[model samples]
Target chain A: MLRKLTVLAAAVGLAFVATSALAASTKEEPVAPSAPWSFDGPFGTYDQAQLQRGYKVYREVCSSCHSMNLLAFRNLGDKGGPFWDPKYKSSVENGYVKAIAKDYQIADIDRDTGDAIKRPGTPADHFVAPFANEAAARASNGGALPPDMSLLARAREGGPDYIYSIVTGYHPAPAGLTVPAGKFYNPYMQGDLSSFWKGDPNKVPVGGFIAMPPPLADGKVSFDDKSPSDLKAEARDVSAFLMWAADPKMEERKQTGLAVMIFLLVFSGILYASYRTLWRNIDHH
Target chain B: MTAHTTYEPKTAIERWLDTRLPIVRLGAEVLEFPTPKNLNYWWTFGGILSFCLATQIVTGIVLAMHYQAGGASAFLSVEQGIMRDVNYGWLIRGIHANGASMFFIAVYIHMFRGMYYGSYKAPRELLWLLGCVIYLLMMATAFMGYVLPWGQMSFWGAKVITNLLGAFPIIGKPITTLLWGGFAVDDPTLNRFFSLHYLLPFLIAAVVALHIWALHVPGNNNPTGVEVKSKADTVPFHPYYTVKDGFAIGVFLILFAVFIFYEPDALGHADNFIAANPLVTPAHIVPEWYFLPFYAILRAIPDKLSGVIAMFGAIAMLFALPWLNTSKVKSMRYRPTSKVYFLVFVVVCLILGWCGAQLPDDAVIPALGKTGINLIDSDLNSYVWLSRIATAYYFAYFLLITPILGLRETPLPVPDSISKPVLAGEAAKKD
Candidate 1:
């Protein structure tokens, strides 16, 4: 029975690995090259200082074109967030988050007059979009609508890794490859570019034309913590921030999982004991 | 023969209730039911499936409280209102989402176990049919539930699956329009799907009642496929199975919790995180993993109508299984030749599922590309061809092998009773 149980456990582990391999299979080239993600494993936790820097990049650069509609201002100071502090019992009361919210004007209706007006953003308010709707967003950015960044990390194949790859994958198009106007070539973007290549059809370039130009440059945004402001650092930082935005409760989830796992293990062990004991007297075959 | 009741009135209120309703007696009779003594770990799936259904229902109800059925608000309600604002809504939604997968896993195992042991044979045909109905309902529920999130996959999956009806002649267009509540998949489709998604589980629960009732009559089919000859061949459901099933459930929950907490998105598609936009279609559209085998079947043929019929026929095989089988041998353990074919059938299903996930035009073996004559619609060396081959075997296993093999094959000697093998010092653990 124990041998069978061990075999079952191994089969389960193998199956999990196999399914993950199947899911991770993508035609995209340069394959979101693996990076050292702080939150890669079950026990992994987000680096708070890195998240804060990531938030800085997002606010200074990404915020202009992209929306974080799912995120509230107070989320920045919530547990596991960029501006989180132990001293703040609630994120709404966090002075740093409050100050940041105050910098934006939020759309509202005046109670007395019932008229639309812009008001100072509150901690409870969702992030303000750069445009009113998808049409306006597309109109502003050539024809490509900059996707909302709230769930950007999760919405891509490799999560933070994919984000980091796309942000930093911009390069000079190989000779014989037609680079269209207002479109930048990115080696990490998933698409077929065979038709756009004048080179050998079989040996066509491994990337696609992206609408957004290279948004990051070396020393674009100076870090408050004096971290390097190279294009790579900025990309990595923002990628991590987007991941946090996508899964803000990861820390709590992992913690709860650990406890639940331990409890179920113990409970199963007890049940096994009782099962063996109760069935002890019965067995002829 | 009716199962004997063990209930005795303890108090005056119990006496009154026993005579008026007998609900207590019914409950006691179930607990005191004589299950076969030699039933193995494979039998534990019944309990695990019940747990899966209850988990889905409880978590689903919680999710509905926070969910909006409107097309516009549906994505927002799921991504923001539930996942963000509501307390532990992430956990609840994760359980509900992942629970569907878990339910299918348990059910597939249960069904296969029945097939392997021939629990679906003879008097248990109605029981198997009832289980089949439950499975059909489950597929419908899971499909509609996926659409409730209103993600890219949700909208597109609904559009693709519902459009299969449009492949039928004449009435197809009208049925699809009626189903969608409009000409296209939109807000009304989401609303009705929500209503149906909420409605189907209780219907499943009602059928489950009949399934259990049907099972209690025939009792359990043991691993040896031997009927009980005496009291020694059976055991009460209490304590022995209760503890055993409890242990299995606890282990199953550990697996469930691992997905809910550590890797909730592992079983889900990344595109689902993006809100559904009818204006833009995604690069790849795939249904949940459980539906992949059927999806492959649907895509096996080039013609849309034929493909749709083939897909539904795959499910219809299960319903017609008992009648198709001609074998008197109840267990594969006694029918060695038949067992080999059954294993191959399982492998074929897995292959079909893998093919379904790949692009139909993609080569199964890249280096061996273009092994046969190229078709106008699909290459012969591609996943489409692979699926066609597997689908052929899938239908053949039911329509040809089961009946013919049952007639020709020589089975090993069978035990006279459930306890006979043990008395003969044979463990009866070959399965």
Candidate 2:
């Protein structure tokens, strides 16, 4: 009976942790529900089909506001990238990537005229910004700056999970909660809503007001593969794409990690055996 | 000295060089040095630390080649140029970043192992002091290294940590100004930090050589804390310790590799990915996990000057440990009471690290969190009070517990020599 009671107590404690963690952002910020991403564990690799769909979400929806200044057209076809092909050893030489690069206009200097000109982008060109500068972007978006998406997946605590959660986490403001002008309620966001809350003093609600309204909706970006294009799907795809942008070397890192781990383990075994053999003649506890 | 001199130069060329340098003889002496047979796995950390230092130096040199120290470009150089554009730059950068954390892990264990075995006592006091100097140099190196990326955390962390000197009266402001090279943490500060970060590692290497020299003078402290009375109590440094330390290092490298590859950013802050913006500040700013205990101690006191003093005092406690511990019995193995206290001290330090990461005003027990029973400004059940309690215990463990326990506690009867326990067990088995 005592053991059963202990087990019951443990279960109760674990349940309490789960509910409290997900229910509200007390001082502990709300944890994003982890999505099953293709790239998560040590052996995990990015799903190319999903990444391709993800690029569509970024280009069609997210690109109008957010910028991926660090990403180049060549990067889209680099080894382990979405458009990568074994046939094209160099990402710049990939025909698909070249075509994609040619679709966009890149800001360039006209060599002869020495004047700024917009020309067809090459594979080497970086992704262009939606707005010319931070001020212009802020002015266009209700005096709130849209953060660059180049490293956004990495900048947040939960990475892609946090991005997915925020994009899909919008909810109707609780009756007692007050949202400031041009702000939307997101349960996944981190903030203190005590002043804005008219609810019970003990219950100030989870999450905070975000400047960006819900950007993802059902059928937001129709995928080429005819995959699901719901709010969650779009959010998940875009989050994955951003993750690729943030950590392009993850595949190589993981692969090298496996080799290093194996070598270390085998080397350790040899060393341990040698240590045992060397100490055999001695008697030191 | 039954063995003949193995390193006596036989060749004419070797004999000609031996009188002038004899570096080969130095190696021979080091490899053949007598070490305590009973030294445990804890002794392996010194070897592991040597490896850690070498890893940091090599990886750091490569990272410096590619890293741009300018404030505006530092983040880009790291995130885009190195991580993406440069070949295998991600691997190099990850190893260097994670290597710092690994170095601290090994050093902390090595230091605590010293404390538990009372390796800091008697003739080894200077040795302990040298080790302390190396630790100080490591922290300085790490702090400056963290500032090089010029990210949000890098900028603000540098700003906050440098401002710590300003807690001192009179000379504080000037020192802070001199350190920053400007009124704020900007490009100039980044440049200077990059230079110093490169410089401090070499200084750590120098101090490490001295640390080893000091160690060679006294030899290693054993688990029994009994001084070597005979040759039977010791073993040669080669084959015995070499293989043992090598095995331990292999194990340490596994952990280091896991962090570098699979979990590269696990030890780092996400805020560091964002470029430094002077106008914007992160909601909650905390130091790296390694510095959390000191951070906790700093915040435990309400007054800024007192907090700063208390934080530095935490490290000063380490230097004063050998003198403060009054026990004739060195190792905690003999002192059961001290063993318990030592365990508590370890836990207290961990609790202090947790406290550092948390908001001071947050409730210690979440159930009683915002009760508003303000005991001197904040809630009675808050982390602030918990931290204060932990800080008090942290000091008391060193200042009060060690001296008092040494005098009062009846310790277990210790063996006369390192080999006594081993021989006694063998004798009992024979009977």
Model 1 lDDT per residue over A1-285, tens place = 874486358436534743653483345457556578898898899999889999999999999999999999999999999999999899999999999999999989999999999999989998999899988999999999999999999998888988898988888999998988999899889888988899887798887889998899999999999999998889988999999999999998999999998999999999989988899898834
How far out, in Å, is residue A206 in model 1?
A: 1.2
| Candidate 1 collision pairs | A285-B422
For model 2, residues A17-117, the per-residue Cα lDDT tens digits are 32232222225566567668889899988888888989989988888999899899999999989899999879999999999999999888999999999
Each model's DockQ score: 0.58, 0.39
lDDT of each: 0.88, 0.86
The interface root mean square deviation of candidate 1 comes to 2.9
Per TM-score, the best of the predicted structures is: 1
Residues B1-431, candidate 1: write the lDDT tens digits.
26566679899999999889988888888888888888877788899998899999999998989999998899999999898889999999989998887788778878888999999998899999999999999999999999999999899999999999999999999999999999999999999999999999999999999999999988888888888788888889886788888988988888888789987988888889989989889887888877888999999988999999999999999999999989998999889999999999988887887787788888888898676778767778898988999999999999999999999999988878876663344565543
Q: Quick one: best lDDT, which candidate? A: 1
Clashes of each: 1, 0
Q: Which ranges in model 2 have alpha carbons more than 4 Å from their true place?
A: A1-27, A31-34, B1-6, B370-373, B422-431
Clash-forming residue pairs, model 2:
none
Lowest summed lDDT window (length 10), candidate 2 chain B: B422-431
TM-score of 2: 0.94
Q: What is model 2's DockQ versus the real complex?
A: 0.39
